[model samples]
Target: MDDVAKGQNLDDFLINLADGLSRAQSRLNRYPVMNAVGQQSMVYHIPRLEFELKLQMTAAETPASSGSGGRLPLQKKSRVQFLPVKASQHQSSSSATSIIKGVFVATPLDATVSQVRLSLSVEKKAARKAQVNVAVIAAPGRSVQGATVELNIDRELSERLNKTPLKPSTRLEQASLILNQESVASAGLIIANQEPEGQIIALIADLFGQTQTLLYRFEQG
Candidate 1:
């Protein structure tokens, strides 16, 4: 049963039990034939019942709003971080695998991120020709599952990244990467096995223009 229903039922039970105990006590007091020992035992039991009743009443009266006690204020910014994955190992291979397996992204429980974009580079050169794939997976805490969003890069920008060299100081705006807020909030990027050895940069931006970046490097194991 739901919490509210359970609480109501408990309240009714306690009330009935209390009324029955009171009636029994009154009957014992009115009957002079009852031995003093029985009366004393009844008195002791009364206090214990009262204590239990008080406990239950207190619990029932407690506010249900306490469920949100652990939640922080919505205005607070949450820190975002990348979950680490074990480096891939290959035997009889001359080069370390650049493919990153199982990439997981995380945000604060109340994060307000609206957009997410990824930048990739190898040997300081833009890896625009490389395709980055991602799959959305469960995040920590009570976040909803199966929410997947896809990011779409425009052809002009894709062509630019493929042709032009990427500068270390390049801003995300300069790259003209367009990110859908809904998709970024629910999805993560996946780099397949064919990706080049480089640094994968994740740029997450909130609605307020505040941005956070997580960088992952793929090297030969």
Candidate 2:
């Protein structure tokens, strides 16, 4: 920044920097945020407005559209800084030793990027309501009591923490229960079933300050 503001007075530079920081803060304040899941992988929602604008810009920059004036660049960018997930925090009930922090990336469907494969076979409780079951093991050789589970059919599973005693209307989206080897926690909720690939299912198990999260792509039958 100092290089870019060459020859500028120190006082003027400080004022400009402060103004820029303030604008950034204001932008963050305008966007709705879900930070309860900060313990695990942080999930951020790039405003739909930005997502849509990005699409328009992509179209404008394409080879066929070069003759037309390109879309103006956006001043701000949204990013997700993926932190290294510590193994001790996430325990997976499925393939116990197979994944770290309960989240695993499946092999690539094509040749380039790896992704988690979407799955189906959910037992439907009613129209638009799909039932999901998850087994949680907070600790080994210990009573899995006092553990709670939260889940929902969201575009991003790790979006937020669902509170217990959720409006009866949304009871199935989140639930609490004693977890154990023989016990399973389940959540059922009415859904849009939007994408062609399937909806994402996120389940979180929290006990004694330990958290386990699973991000699964769920396909509708």
Candidate 3:
């Protein structure tokens, strides 16, 4: 689900749960969030709003105009930087390994773009497994509904990662961090054995380029 839709879903969960707040203290413990400072307290109403939005989105058979001129898959312009990959021990060509990481960033989706997808990777020696962390930083004026962000690993890459072995002490990748509206963008790393370093970097570049191309087309339109 897109960030908006997931948020909406979470909102509904909270509201429904809140309805039974008669035993306030009992349920209160269930959600330590309500005890938070200021804005955190407002987390209580999320569930209700999410439920309502879900109903509305579902009832609307036709795509409700987003009230914007963005393309079918709306996306925004954003930049991704791959910080260095520090591995414990570099492997030779004979080894098949893979390393992956998440590069998080915060920026707006071009008025023309609606969806955003990213990929990050590093060289590998032996066949290894890889994973990526994904998130959506909502756009200011746009709405994302049931937005599905998929992590695609081609058959060839998938097979390679599954068979690679891991390097015990190497920090193939770093952990990913999730950021919100007021927070800075960040990412996590999932390094493995199998995928080549050159191949991994190229894949990441390709993912960014593809997103850029989509945004470009939308802007040009």
Give per-model TM-scores: 0.18, 0.30, 0.20
Q: Which pairs, if any, clash in model 2?
A: none
How much is the lDDT of residue 78 in candidate 3?
Answer: 29
Which one is best on lDDT? 2
Model 3 lDDT, residue 89, Cα: 47
Kindly list the per-residue Cα lDDT of model 1 for residues 1-221, writing each as its tens digit.
Answer: 34333434544644566677766654343222324432112222233343222221111222334346658543432222212224362222222222222212223335544233222222322333222333222233323223332233222322333433223432322232323432223222333345445533333222222222223343434
* Cα lDDT tens digits for candidate 2, 1-221: 42222333333434554565545543342232334652233323222221100000010111223333657543432222212235454533321221112112222235332221111234666555667666544224444444444333332332333322122233345555544445465556555534233434444443332234444443545
Positional deviation of residue 216's Cα in model 1 after best superposition, in angstroms:
2.2
RMSD in Å for candidate 3, one decimal?
Answer: 28.7
On a 0 to 100 scale, what is the lDDT of residue 90 in model 2? Answer: 55
Q: Residue 161 in model 1: shift from native, Å? A: 12
Give lDDT: candidate 2, residue 41: 38
What lDDT tens digits, residue by residue, belong to model 3 across residues 1-221? 34243344534544554454424432332232322321113212222211111122221122344446755554442222212224554534433333332222324446677444333332223334333334444445644344433232222322343343223322314333333443223233333343334332111111211221010000101
Cα lDDT computed for each candidate against the true fold: 0.32, 0.38, 0.31
The clash numbers for all candidates, in the given order, read 4, 0, 49
Model 2: runs farther than 4 Å from truth?
1-127, 138-140, 150-171, 193-197
